[model samples]
Structures are given as structure tokens and as C-alpha cells.
Target chain A: MPQQKLESVEDLAAKAKALRRDVLLQVYKAQSGHPGGSLSWIDIGVALYYHEMAVFPEDPANPARDRFVLSKGHACPAQYALLADQGFFPKAWLETFRQYPTKLQGHAENHYTPGVEVTTGSLGQGLPQAVGIALGLKVQKAAQRVYCVIGDGESQEGVIWEAAMAAPHHKLDNLCVFHDLNGLQIDGDVKKVMNINPVPDKWRAFGWAVKEIDGHDFTQILEALAWARTVKGQPAMICARTVKGKGVSFMENQAGWHGVAPKTEDYEKALAELAD
Target chain B: MAGMETAGVGGKVGVVMDSLRDAYGDTLVELGNEGANIVVFDADLAGSTRTSKFAKAFPDRFFNMGAAEQGMVAAAAGASTTGVVPFVSTFAMFATGRAYEFVRQAVGVGHQNVKIVATHAGLTVGEDGGTHQCLEDLALMRMIPGMTVLSPADALETKQAIRAAYAHKGPVYVRLTRDKFPRIHAEDYRFQIGKAVMMRPGTDVLLVGCGLGTSICLAAADLLAAEGIEATVLHCPTIKLFDRETLLRLAKAHRAVVTCEEHQAHGGLGGVVAELLSEAHPMPLRRVGVQDQFGQSGKPEKLLEAYGVTPQAVAAAAKAAL
Candidate 1:
């Protein structure tokens, strides 16, 4: 782990605000992407990249560096923003997101993007891959940890439970996964579509060290990550309750914004709201 | 040539047979012992897939991912990112069918170094019937971009194919059978990934085969020889990384070609050869295998005969092509 001092909560919050602006801009430019999930996931993504995870943007494939997987791949604008900000690629490339021949693919393509550890556009795949990386680290007796963020909606995939069951069975203490529990999916309420309620109980039953936190709160997000490090002999799950589309006044808690790209007028209002 | 005659000669019953999965399991142990940073994952079919041998040998390196092939395949892709070669196994149906998208996205698109050695392929899966037997695995696996597809003929080729898959970087899907098969390659046979082995050197017709189909092809060659129609037998184990040069060269020498496999005729070796010949050397061609139909429960040999995947069927197809 890098011994660099953790960024202050306020600074991290400001950076997340910038990332939020970047996310909205990228989605607006692409004219196609999941802005709601991106907004919901940005805060947690910021907390991991800016403070908790030991990731080297210069040498992205450093064996000792921590790994991250965006399992809910539709929300890639947020991850793309973070990678760009971290110097994983040129910041200008964010404008090319979802465009033809752009390296910033609509979904996370690990081979195309430098810092992205795994390709995960498909729902319910990242957790198992994270588990595999953790198991591989354990086999090599390496200290590098693995981090993954999954959409609450993505939990409906049966492979999630399969990975969830396997991690604890293998005693994968080095894996830390976060659930972006934004309470909404593309098809309206997640509850109506598929109720994954009692989320903490589910993780506990699956043999993970579980924590519930306000996902938007930088302190809570950071604290949960710190707490995940203290866990031993089992993987950690941080279920973060968050509004569907956070920060923007009109978008928050709105299922309609789940995948629809904001129109120019809506984009202006959203940008104004996120402006420093 | 006489050695090739031993395969599928006096029926599949009395002949000593070798299990492809047995060779696969033993090869995994061999690879593990050679200090290869290799890991094995099985989705609750270790006993059948023969990954149990590796699991017993390297208890720590082996992982039984339960019945979750999707998770197993994805996890193997993840493990490969960390520089460990992960060999995943399950019955052919689940490995390619149950977990197709995972294999496509994680291993294929991501270009991860994961070996998917799927056992229990084709009509040879016998009593399990069509649902368990995967006749379209070759087609499914071949469609994946950058995926190396292999269908070894016998035990010796199975072992060498495993080693080749391990040595090769990127994703590879190997198709193996449930039943023990007669050996087609000589003891001195050295396997190469893209090179086809010439089992016999006749020129009346070209008989192509992979997996159990190779033995069938060799038997068809013998049957054809007795009737004054000398045929060439080409064993094509690697379906995707095919020996196009050798195939086209042999195609030039022979009057016609007959491709055989235990898979659906639409997209296994037959489809591959058709696609190749249509572009390169279009000649009188006949694909001898299961027609577009599901297999039924029966004795393995009986199933082969019923599905029109036998030597007689191949010989007839060869004669028809000629």
C-alpha cells in the first residue's frame, strides 16, 4: 500500500464534484450512457481511487497495485472520468466516450483502457473476477488487494450469488466489494423488478464481513473502506444506500434518468447545479 | 497405415480404449509439477471431467467452483489477469452452453489466458442424451474472437493439446469426449497446434476428422481402400487454428473431400472445411456427422451408429463425395 497521506475528506469531496461534472459532460457528449448510475457510483469510485486504493496510474499494470472492477458496466462514464483524472489516459479522451473508434468504450474494456483491470460491461461478472484476482493474490502470497463495485440491480444475476458463496468458502480476506444500492434500475424500482431487500443480511448469510453506509457521505465511504482492511479470513461487502441520480436536483432518486442521456437544456441545468 | 487400421476395426467393444479426460487430468498434474503457475477450476464435474486428479495433486491450486460455470469462467479470466494460467473444466454443455456469454466477454473479448478444456462433448455423452451432450461447442467456441479451439483425437493428442493450450497465451477452448477412444496418432507423434497430422497417404479422396471423428475417418479410409478407392486421412485436432496449407495441399491431391465429426454438421469440422474449401479449393464435398438433429440415449457405439457418425457412414460419404 502507498504510504502517501490520505486526502482530506473536504478535498476528496471537491474532487468528486469535479468528477461529477466530468461524468455529466462525458455522458452529455456521448449522447448515450447511464448518467443516473454513474452519479450514484461516482462518490464511492472517488473514495477508492483518490484515498483508499493503492493504484499507480503511471505504471498501471504494477503487480502490487490494487485492482478495481466496475461490475455494473453501464455506469462507465463515472469510471472513465476517474481514470482520466488519475492520468490513466488523456483527459480529452473522455469526450470520445461511446463514440466510434474511441478507446473510452461505452462499457469498461480492460484491454483498451490502461488502468481498468478487467473488462466488465456485462452485469454480475466483476465480483467473480475480483474473487479470482483475490484468490490469485492469495496463491502468490501477495499483499495486493482487489476492489469491486456492483450495481444493486446487478445483484439479480445468479452469478453474483455464486461468486458471493465462493469468496467466503475460499476465505478471501483481501477482496472488498461495494454495492451501489441506488434503489432504482432501468426498469423503474429495483424492488418491483426484483427485491434484493435485506441486502446486509444477504451478504452476511453469504459469509462476508458486511457494512452499511451512506454512499454519498465521503467520511462514511472512507470509513467503510478502512474497516474492510481490518477484516480477516473473509471478503468484505459495503452496501451503500444512495439516491439513484445524486447531486443534480432534478435527477436524484429518479428512475427515468437511469439510462437516458440528458438533453441540452437538461444538461445545462445539471452542469449549472454541479458548477464550482 | 496398418497402425491406423487398428482404430475402430473390430467394433469399439473389444478394442482397448483410452479416455481423453484421463489424459487431460494427468496432463494437468504434469503441468502443475513442472512449476507452471497454473490453477484448475471445475464446476462440480471434476469426477467426470477428470480434474479430480489435479485437485488431488495440488489441493491448494485447485478450486471446485461448485455448479457455477459462469462464475468459474469469469474467475479464471480474473486469475489470468494476475499472470496465473487457469485451466477450467466442466461438461461440454455447461462449459460452452451454460456459460457462453461469460466465456465471450471475460475470456474472449478481454483476451485473457484461460484454458477451457470442456469434456463430455457430442453424441458420445451417451445416456445423458442431447441436453448434456454439447454438439455445437465447436461452433460456439470458434465464433469467439481470438479463441483457440481444439478437438484432440485420442489420449496422446489430448495430453499434448493440454500442454499446448497451457503454453499458448490468450483464451483456448478444447473439446473432449466422455467415452474412451482408440488412439489415432503414432507413439512418436509430436502435436502442434495448427498443424494437421496425415494418418494415411492415399489420394482418391480426403477424409478429415477431429476428436472421435479422426478414428472414424481412419476406419473409413480402410473401408474405402478394400474397394479400390484409396483415401487420405487427415487428423485435424485444432479446429480454429487449422492447418490451411496442409488442408489445401491435400485437397489439391484428392478428387473429393469428406469431413467427419461427432458434432452437428452445421458448424463443426464440416462447416470449417466447407468455409475453407468454398474460398480456397471448392471440390466435391460431403460432410459426414450428425445432421441438424438431437441425439438420444443409448450405448455410445450405438449412439454413434444411430447418429450416422460411424466408419460406414463416413465411407459412404467419402464415396458420395468422390
Candidate 2:
């Protein structure tokens, strides 16, 4: 019942910081995950899972629960951290992240994790799954909403547009996609590699109800989700503007950290900064 | 096809003829009547792929993914996670070629329970030309792990195979054709996955085939028998989980093996037979199919014949082996 109301911005931001710390720790242990992308999107994760979305971590597959798909699968450390906080799995699962045969892989896959709804690692796959699941839920006349997160760089794939076209055509208002508008990808800045400029306009053109927000702001994330739920006859797209490596001082705004993990000293420094 | 009659266990050979696509539609309606959680998807080719019948019958369950094969496939994979038997239909070219990575990642890697019923397979797609022919579909689908590949010869076989594929829980690729084919099985032909059916028995030459090529082998056997050749005909509808035991036994018992198919000679039925024989029983073999070449615009029967996949060609291939 407390989840129905947005938590204080200070509390949600603190939760986000802890999640960020967890993301850095897991990526540090794995030594091979996308820390930059994961860090950039943890705020949205914190907002959605902790303060928003009616989800049962114990019965993850419960038909009555809202669905969440991380289309930017490389950003799973953030999700893994948040899911741990929510008790979807033991907080101990984060300690075993990226260890072979463990539930936490380098990317989020539904088969491995109990709370994940779609197996996403390949970019541009998750939104379509969300659209399909939304369609299915709509057909069944269910009340559960579906939330999906895609990256700005992942927007380059053709399947994303295919799903963009489909969600609106089906009039799936139950679907709300958050584009983690972190300008940096594996190659560097998304604008330099290939600009996803005029992003909101494009979604609007595709017939989705588009909203622009600061992704790191829990207030805006909550507002967009709330507004999206009220919108009828179209899917909603929240273009969440964010920094690539958000929390840590050295890592923030650096594309080089997109995948490569921090060293022990660097991790200690990051943990100390968060401790401050 | 209201009361589309079915008959005995491989008893009535060549009694009726119908298109696999239409038979697929009729069978889907029958299955839809005694239904479970079966949902149909087509990439804007419902009229052509014959999934429109299912859409009409079970309007609530059918999802017409307009012209986007890649996303459609991934979405079907998504639907499967929610415990729905997803039957995704599209042209073979789009299903296997256009969305190979989507299928590979979603169905292959995700391990989703999706049945890909691709129509207009091989050279028989006619008029749509080489772009739509899709000769490499069987080869491509076979390469995927945990995928059941079935290329049924005629309407009856296609009908039964669709049901069997639905019942077997996992990913399946059933290639259907554009034109109706000569029915080699009785109306009540029950399809068993991974087991080749012995159409006819003989000792001089074993003529093995699948899809339209199975009937070609039957016709070749008739021609061979006329010349006192007495060729055994083996119909291998399931190409991936191929009947290795039956193939080994027959190859061991027979004089030589001649494989025929309406697909590429390298990776379709011919390749499967050759690979099986190469390992288990190394016997003399001759393959009757298209060489490494793409198909062209023409009539279905004419294209099959012109591409050197006729009854006479199969008979000649078997005779040459002898």
C-alpha cells in the first residue's frame, strides 16, 4: 500500500545510491559486465521497482503482478542489485553475479533470474517482448502494467522500430518503455557513433505518448509512470536523460567504463565516495 | 475441407491430392476446435500462409504481426514464456532468412516453445522468384540446437505433422509448400516425429526422399519396378531428428541408397542421409536434388522438373547408383 504513493525523493535517491553501490560491487566481482550502462539506469530501476510497480518478488510469475523487462540487457547489474534489495532472490545472488551457472549472468535473462520477464542481452529484443506481453495481457483483460527499459544506443536496431510501430498500433496503453538516454555506448558517445536525436519526436511520430524526463530524478520517473498509466489508446515512451557512468566521480560520463569494470583501488574509492 | 476424410496407416497411397497450405488451415481449425492455449502469428501473410483460418476461428488468440518477421518471432518467444503454444507462420524466406538471428537468439538461445510453420518453402513458391524460394530453410533450421525440422510431403502428412509438432513441447520448424502435392499416405496417416516411414520395400535400390521429393521417389519406384528394379522407398519427413536407426538398418539391408528432395543437395534430406550413411553404414549413394543454385520464376511443377527434381530424375539417379 505504501508503494501506491511515491516515497520521499531523499529516501528513493538514497535507495538508488545503495543500488548503485551494489551494481559497482557486482560488476567489480564479475570483472566483465557493463558497469556504465548499469549505473546510468539504476535510478529508474530504484524508482520503478522500489517506489512503483506492484510486483511480488516471491511469486515472480504471478499472473496478477506487473511485468518489467530490461531491454538494455547489458544493464543487468543495476537490475540485479535492485531485485536483490526487493528479495526476488537472496541479496547473496549479487555476490555470485556472473559466476558461471549462477542466476546472475552478465546480462539479464528470464530463464536464470526469477523476476526477469524477458531474456534480453541482444539489444532491441526486450521492448518487442514487452509489447507482445502487453498485447497478451490486454487480450486477457488483465490489470497488470508492463515496464521496459531500452538504451539510447540500442535504438539503432531495426527491431526496436518494429516494436515501436506495433505497440501503438495495438493501442497498448499498459506498456511504458523507459529509454535510458545515456549518450555513451560501447563505441563511445551515441551521438557521435550514431545520433538518436529527436528521439521523443520519433516516438511521437510512431504514435506513442512521449514524455521527456531526467532519469536520475525519482520524482520525474514516478511522474512519467503515473501519467503513462492514465494515457489511453497508445503506448507511452519515457525518454529518460541520464549520464553514462552516473554515481562514481571518476567513472561518470566515461564511455570507456561502459563494459570494463573498476579495479580494486578504484572500487574502494567508489565505495568510499558512496559512503560519503 | 469440412469433413476432409482421413484413412489407414500408410494404406491408401496416392488416392487424393491437396495443397499443404489449405490442409494446414483445415487441420488448424480441427485442432482449434479441440483446443488448448494455441496462439497463431503471421507476418502480414495470413492469406498466403493460411493462418487466417486460425485467426478467424480463434480471433482472440491470433496476432497478425504486420510485415515485421524479426520482432514477430521474438514476440512469439515472449508469448511462450507465459505458457502459450505459439504457432508463428510466414513465408519461409522471411521466417528463416530475414529473421535467422531473431530465431537463433529468441527461440534457439531463449529456448522458447515456438512452432515456426513457414509456408512457400523450397523452389515451389513459384512466381515470387528466387527471393521467396527459400531452399536453405531446412539447412538453416537444422543447424539450430533443439529445433525439430519437418518437411511433410503432402496435405495429410502436413496435417498430422502439425499436430505432432504441437504435442511435442519445444521449438519446431515445419516447412509447408505453395502447391498441393500427391498424397502418399492414407487419410488417417498418423505422423510420428523422428521416424522415417517405409513407403515401399525392396532390395535393389533404396530411394529415400522428403517433401514433394517423397512422391517423386514413389513414382521413381513405380518406374523402377516396371523395369524389374524393385527399389525400396523411404519417406523421411523429419530431417533434424532423423530416423538414424531405421536408416542404418535399411542401408545395411539394401544394395545402395538414393536420396531425393526439393531442397539443396548439400544440407537437406540428401545431406542428412549421406551423413548418416557415412557414419553408421557407408554405402553407395546417389542424391537427386537441386545443385548449388537458386530458383527462378515459373510454374511450381515446371520449376521442380526444370531444376532436375522430377520422378524421372530420381529414377535415373537410383538407376545410375545401381
Candidate 3:
């Protein structure tokens, strides 16, 4: 299914808001999942799926189509929401988010779910796979680009840096990574737990074309992605400053909601706040 | 089997000694020449693992992920999703131990078509000592669901095993030794994944082995034969898709069984044979391996003898089992 092009920022923002609601609803119904990171990443996921990527949900395995990897795979509710919205699978499968025998696993599983390009749950695995995909495409001289979204907290994994160092070394300009810097992990603040501070500087020093942007803003997200495409001889890293719970007020900037399901009252309040 | 002029049982295992990693590298070059959509990844050990040969032949298809086994494995897993077969090589110590989680999550759980050819397994890594030797790789790789594990006995088997690993779908781990090994499996020998070859047929005892341990079993069988104790030597190159039917049949025929491997007696081929026999056909068995101890720096030959993984050890174990 071809995604309807949203040329206007209002249209893209509206789509992202709807996705946020879907993400919360999936989490509320399942009474599980990482809401904070999902909320933080939905806008970027929305921009990639709806605005930037050349994906056909009908031909999910199209070799020419661009690929996306949720390196911080716990934020899969956002990806599932976007994938379902884009008609990769029936929208109703969202209700079976973390349910047993459901394709929509608690973490993104490529084998089980359509449009999910890689299986990821254990942190620090997804990005290197993205690097691999990019490297393979480069080897084939394929034009298709690879995009990956990683969490700030997930950066603590040594493998993440290993990928960070490798992508630039291979000159994977076809690859782009968006760091979802929401400043919170499960325990508390990412800085307090394990600071991956100096994020953009690290990426730049590692030879990536680095950019910092407001992750929730459609204009900046789209512009940064376009900028990433123009980069050559190096991978692109966009350090996106975002709120932990982006659209919902009560959960915003709150670390406690990192992997918590919304109570019924919280769900009603979140839904009311997300109303058009 | 041509050129098998009076050697080990089945007229296989000639006197020529060759390196398993060299065979692996040559097979990779052969696959590349065959137009297989194959990519090779090595974690800064291309020179040691012999994947540098592939790197030289096909630079575009080769990636030297500098000293980063986890990233190399994950990248290989990622690359496999694009309908390209990626063969990742690293020392067994780093490949299966340091970057174990990556292998489990990216390759095993994802069920991606990535071949992990871990060279320099077991104490045969020699002078590197225990820190660089991995004796538990077989157990680690086999325990992962949907993983195919193989440990080829010699250079000839290593070449065929690499081909077999590529032909099969999903994740595969091929174990190789750093040291040179005697050539087993004759020129016409075909390697069927998950099957064991009966090197020597006997009725008194059953001898099971993989990798260098298989060579030791052959020698042990010769020793047993001289002692008027006939033993069946089953060279089990493929450990995961274990030839249980053959093992069970041989076990019923023999009075006792003994398993040998250049690894820990608790895991690897020894552990696998123990698990299989205890469940299907329980019998007196002896495991000749490292006996659950760390290896120290020594010559490969001395290490094998010191660890009690030699033909003498296997022969002794077989006698004890009897």
C-alpha cells in the first residue's frame, strides 16, 4: 500500500498524533511495553514511514525498498503503530501487541511481523545489523538506503559504539541513524545511570556527518533526514532531542513510564489529551 | 574413494596433514567463484582465520570489522536478511565467548542465514593458552535453538562442511582448529549435514569423536584392535543434527562407548554423546577431553597430551569403560 504523501507539516503532525494514540492504546490494552521510548520515537518513525522512506507495505520484501531498524527495539509499539497505519498488516493486530501467539511480539521480530526488518529486543543489536544492510547494499551498488533509530540509554552497550566506529570506516553514507535522546532510562535519567553525554561530538569524532535536531518537530526531522541523504563518504547521525513521553502531559519527562502500561484512568486521560 | 592407499578405516584419512582454516578459506574462495551471493566478515582476525585470502580475492565482498566480534556478527546477521549469505569468521574464543549474545540474538533467534566459521577452537589453539582457547563453543552454539553446529575432522572435511553449512538455511557454526590436522575423508567423500561416517567398524566398543578428537579415536581404534578389542569409530563431524540413529545402532552392537574431543569433557561432542546415550540407550561411557580444567601455554602436541585428549587417553578411557 502506497502511503498518502503528507506535504504539509500539519498533516504529518496530525498523523504522528494519531500514531501516538494508537501506540498508547496498544500499550494500555496489553498492560505492558515501553511507553516512554515509544512515545519519544513515534515522531521520527512517523517522519520516516510517512514522509521519507520508499516502502510498499504490500511488497514488504521488495529488494529496492528502503529498510528501517528499531535498534532500541523496546520502542516497537511506535513502529507497529506506524506499520499498521501504513497497511503492512491489519490495524487490528495492534490490539494483540504483546499477546501470545501474536506476530506483534513485545520486541520487534522480523520473522514474525511484516515490515519489521530486523528482530531486536536485547539492546545494542539493531544498529550493527543496519550497518550490515547498508554495507551489503553498498557492495551491490544498490541505491536503497537504510535508516535506524537508537535510544540514548541503549548507547551504554559497547556493541553500539562498535557499530558507530564501523559504519564510518566502511563509508556507509547510505546509512542514517537517529539517536532518540529522551534523557531517561528505566532506572532514572540516562546521565545519572550511564551518561552517553557528548553524543553528537562522539559521532562527529567517529567520522559520521552529525546533526542535532528537535526530534518531535516534523520540519526539522524531515530536513535532517534530507541532510543525511546528501552526506557522502560517512554515515549520518542525528542526535534528536526529544521528550520521554512526547504527547502525553502526565508522562512527559517521567522515567517511571519507561516500560509501564497505563492504568485505566491514565489511559482515559492520555486519550483525552491526545484528542484532535 | 581414490588415493586411499592403505590408511585409516574405510580407506580414508591419508598421511597428508593440512590446516582446517586454510581449507575453510579456500572453500570460501570457491563459493565466491561459483557466483554465490556470499559476503565474508572477520573480526580483525582475517590473517589468523585465513579469511584474508577471501579478502584478497574479493575485496568488495569482504569486511574486516576491526577487533569487534559483536558488531561483525550482528552485521553478518543484518546482511543475511537481504538475501545474501554472510560467512563470519573469528577465533573461537572471541566469536563464541566474547560476542556470544550477539550470536544468540542476531543469528540464532533471528534465524538469519549467517554462517559463523569459528576457527582455533579448543586447546589446540596451543600457545595462546586457556584465555584464547574456547572448549565450550559447541555447547554454547548448540544450546541456541535452530542453530546447526559442525566440527569437521580435517582439511577435506572442513571444505565439505563449509559447503554444507552454506547449502543449509538458517544459522550455522563451524568449528575449526588453529593447528594442522591429518586429512580424513577420501576424494569422493560427500559430507551430508547431520550425518556421521563410520571410520572403523567393530563390535566390542563404540568410539565417538569430532574435530581433532576424531583423529585421536582412529588412532585409539588401532590401539584397541592391537589389544584384541575391536572398537567402532564414528567420526561425528556434525554435532547439532547428531546421527543418533547410527549411534544408537552402534551402541546396541558394542559393549561400551567412549567419546573424545579436544574440549571440556562436560560439553562439546563428549557432552552431546553422553546426553544422547543416557536418553536413548544407556551404557557405560568414558569422556576423554580436558576434564573440566583450564589449559596453560604449551605446544599444541604437548597440550593435547597434557589434557589427556590423545589416542593414549582415548584408549585408556575405552579400556576403563570396558
**How far is A122's C-alpha from truth in model 1 (Å)?**
1.3
Q: For candidate 1, lDDT tens digit of each residue in B205-242?
A: 99999988888888888889999999999999999988
Q: What is the interface RMSD of candidate 3, in Å?
A: 0.8
Please give the distance, in angstroms, between residue A106's alpha carbon in candidate 2 and its true position after superposition. 2.5
For model 3, what is the alpha-carbon lDDT of residue A39?
A: 96
- TM agreement with the true structure for every prediction: 0.97, 0.93, 0.97
Which of the two, 1 or 2, has more TM-score?
A: 1
DockQ of 3: 0.81
The chain B TM-scores of all candidates, as shown, are 0.96, 0.94, 0.95
Give the alpha carbon lDDT tens digit for every residue of A1-276 in model 2. Answer: 123324788888888888888998898887878889998888988888877788787778878788898999989998898788887888888878999769998877777887888778899888888887887777667888889999999999999999999888878999999999989888888889998888999999999999999998888888888899889999999999999889898999999998898899999999998883
- Full-model lDDT, candidate 1: 0.90
User: Ranking under TM-score, best-scoring first?
Assistant: 1, 3, 2
Rank all candidate structures by their lDDT, best first, as comma-separated numbers: 3, 1, 2
lDDT of 3 at B36: 91
Q: Which wins on DockQ, candidate 1 or candidate 3?
A: 1
What lDDT would each prediction earn against the true structure?
0.90, 0.85, 0.90
Candidate with the larger lDDT of 1 and 2: 1
Q: Lowest-scoring 10 consecutive residues by lDDT in candidate 3 chain A?
A: A1-10
Every candidate's DockQ is 0.86, 0.54, 0.81
